[model samples]
Target: MIKSPTAHEISYGLVELNPDGTIQRANDEAKRVLISEDGDSNYLFHRITNNEIKTKLHECFMGRANEFIVTIDNQPVFFLFHRSNNEQSQDRIHVYLFNIYNLLTLHDHNNWNNHLLSSIGEMAAGIAHEVRNPLTAVKGFLQLMEQTYKEEYSHIAQSELDRAIHILNDLMSVSKPEFVQEEKAAFNVCSKIESILLLFQNQLYDINVIKSFQDETAMVVGRRDQIKKALFNLIKNAIEAMSDGGTLMIEQYEDGHDVHINISDSGVGIPKDKLRLLGTPFFTLKQDGKGMGLAQVFNAIQSNHGKIRVTSEEGIGTTFYLSFPKKSQYSTQFIGGNTMLQVVDSKTDLTDFLFKNLDFYTREWVQYLEKNKSYITSLLKENGEMEQYDRAGNPIMKLVAQNILEIKTELIMDVAKERGVKSAKTEFPMHLAWELFQSSRGIIWNAIKSFYQESQNTLSTEEFFTLERNVNDIIDLYIDSYTAYYVNYKEDLLKSHRETVDELSVPIIPIAERVCILPIVGNVDTYRAKKIREKTLVRVKELKANQLIIDISGVPFVDTAVVNHLFKIVKGIKLLGCSTILTGISAEIADTMIELGIEIDNELKTRSDLQQALQDIQQFRIGKD
Candidate 1:
């Protein structure tokens, strides 16, 4: 009687061999593993006896070897032969066969580890070479200070030395073979991280560190130093990644029974495969890297009963997420009606917390919308044909179509923003609203374009009247809503005044042949200051003016930087052999100049008003005559 093999036995390719080692019965997997479908079972063992493997199998059968590895039909197999009884007649040699596939897999893994270690070693050597110059400079400075000014400026020199030591420590940390030493302590996590960012004050010129803490006093009961080190490692990685520089965001919030922290970098991102093994020891793609930073991060997180997750792409950037269990509050108090009272505490909702504290999204969205509107207005003003459409298939409509197509870009900015704000409940609504607005605007623009095209050929009085009314109605609806919402919500949004028409002036004064004047009408900063410089240069060159007057009477304010930029422009004009007279220093501006101790070089003449400036330039011209 024969029993069928169980699923496990069949799956594992288990088979029992007869005393002589000829095949007694074979499972489906055993047959598949040992012999091809066309090969005969009687001839399978005989066929396997010709190669070097036959010699090994014979050794195993003769009890010369306890186990032998052989290949049958190019498939690797591990054979074990043993006798159940010592007596020759009753003795039966049992042979067990395994595919050795798992052993081969283990071998491959070992080889990969060896390769990874070799690469890491090479990277470590490079890092050492790269950091040595800075280290030497720091060491030399310290020694010189100790010999020259240690007694006089010991405190200051010691501080500089300490900073140098810290940098050296960071470099050594990367190269060190020691594992992370975890010292657990309860700490105000937000405050601790904020302090770390504050240390990078001088280096943050091109970097903006935006901190969003759901709880100002959020605490974590963990290894404070280890967490701080991990945060620094991630931020340092970010700064190095963004060669051009960008924002580093550190966000902290609490989910139900859990505290979450996210450190994101807007820098060169990691490859998907590399990102997967980012926390694996000695896995990095950086030119001079030991790959231990993220490995240490992983260890710190695990030891603290926390989890760390990383998401990255090749071009966009990378984000590190750290989460830990929230601690229970011992007591709660409500200061209401001039009395402090104990109350049943409910875990605060992060949505309500954020809504009450921060609405960066709403402000950012409003600014974005205003900028988009300004861009559209500029396009319309610059391209006259785009603002108007005519009948008879005008060629100008092609330019209009081209401009529209250019403006119709995918609204992916909100996608990136939403990804960063995924864990925030308060921003979710704002993100959705922005996405809807972008989508709706595209649809409406396309619909209006279609309607305009359809009505373009219909020059009949009735059709023309209908089309004109429809276009006006659509535009009015949009403009009215925009004006109403913007005027109500953001009345003082732009620096330019909206209501006082007289307060603003757009006077045109002839400077030279085919040249006119543009009196700057409002406050100017470094950005707008550059614009004035550019406009002046272009107009001066275009007009070939020998004498020009810049009237600044309408300007409300001017800083020293603005004044310096003006002086630079004057010098530039002088290099062109052109004379510049500044005309419009109001009493307030005059007072500001005096208060600020600003002195303008006498090369350029200035007057109390534009008329006086013009008069001065005219007098100079008359004197030249």
Candidate 2:
């Protein structure tokens, strides 16, 4: 049966209303639209709709504008209102409602699809271009090998193939970061960066490396290796850009809640027109670069809850600014060493004042600690442990100041206990640790007095006494918690060591004065390799060793990745002014390295056995003396 459509069933809505916006007659669609927006039918019999729509209705009644829009169900619905029979007795308003939501959505979807296809095509072209260059090199090397029957040609081909593989690996990492998962840990930013800078020791001969680390203990929590890789790429690019030898400045400072790291280079800068595409895949300025480096750098930083910004000029230079949320609980509001009266406004302001000038307090404390004639203090200074002492102690002091701002007793105690455990693990003396806290009381009071004096802000006697008591109470709580944890940790040290045997895999044993032996055994994975690098560097500094003996005789097999890690470790040691002697290269491992076309750095010394290596070191030291 064919049915004729009624007025209510038409495509568009129609309504007739009085001059005052009272609904005289309306179709079902018209009623539905009004109900959805107003949420009731009271507007149908009311004098006018709401104040939001009254202006439009008044304009329609006065023969002014006739069209307007109202959002219904999150879609814009157009309304056309016309005053009818203005010259006759029948004074009425005719309204037509139209919805174009589906049309707009279809338009947007088609546009987006076209853009996606275009982007896909561009990326595909870039991949092909990058992949073809290395393949072309490999092909040339293979042809040479075939004609000359030379092993050098084969090695070059293998190296070219490795390059291709590296490019593809980078692409996969940026596209799918989940392919490799890493654990997050809190590490000292200054220390890690210093280590990375050491990797470019050879390249630094022509360049000046300037480091301005304001907050040495600026800590961040992320995948340490990934962060290291990103930093390495940027620093490497900075070095490469300055081919004619320019200054490479790396600066780190902390603001209120974020840490800022700026790496600037004085080199041939990028074009301003191309600045917006700096991090896009396959967009680069270098001739031989794969163009994936910055892409990976951008992805790595963002994935680690960090932000990156870059600015460049054509002839001057470029700078990459990276910011990460600091893992501290204090506010660093003091900028440019300027103190204002606002810093002493109230009790909370006093706490902030202390934090803002924390560096001053730390410097004073370090000076006092260094002046002490105790054996522990002398060893700390001589072994370069003073910097670490400063880094570790700064946080606890900041926490104490934070506690004064707001009372969080449990959190303070837990952190103090953890610090205690750390001290015990590192074999730090409990007496000196306690003395560190005790000495801060006097330093802090002096700073507070100066703070008030410098700002000319006075506090009542009662207020000053109450502040002193609060500070002492929190310090005492921290000391108590730390002492308890320190004692308990010492008692269970052996059990804890047994549970964490993996951590003991990279044991740096002191073989003699100014020398240490690192005996690596078993399989070396990426995770363990990173731990080895960190531990080895730290132990070398602690022992004040001038040379390191890396005995890999016990390492059963050597893969390409392990070789790369070993090479990096040696380079890092070199940067620390320490020489590395690699021993126990078995025939099988040598064959694997050669087959993989690995090239050892010329400066790295090698010996057949540990005894021979020891003899070589003894002769060299004796001759120097």
In candidate 1 the C-alpha lDDT for residue 471 amounts to 31
lDDT of 2 by residue, 42-141 (tens): 3443433445556665656664555777665666767787666431244987888766453333444455444444555666788888889889999998
**Best by TM-score, which number?**
2
Model 1: colliding residue pairs: none
- Name the lDDT value of residue 442 in candidate 1: 46
Candidate 1 lDDT over 18-44, as tens digits, reads 667666565665555554465465543
* Each model's lDDT: 0.55, 0.73
Our model 1 lands, by Cα RMSD against the true structure, at 26.3
TM-score of each predicted structure versus truth: 0.31, 0.35
lDDT score at residue 29, model 2, on the 0-100 scale: 73
TM-score attained by model 2: 0.35
Instruction: Report the Cα lDDT for residue 467, model 2.
Output: 55
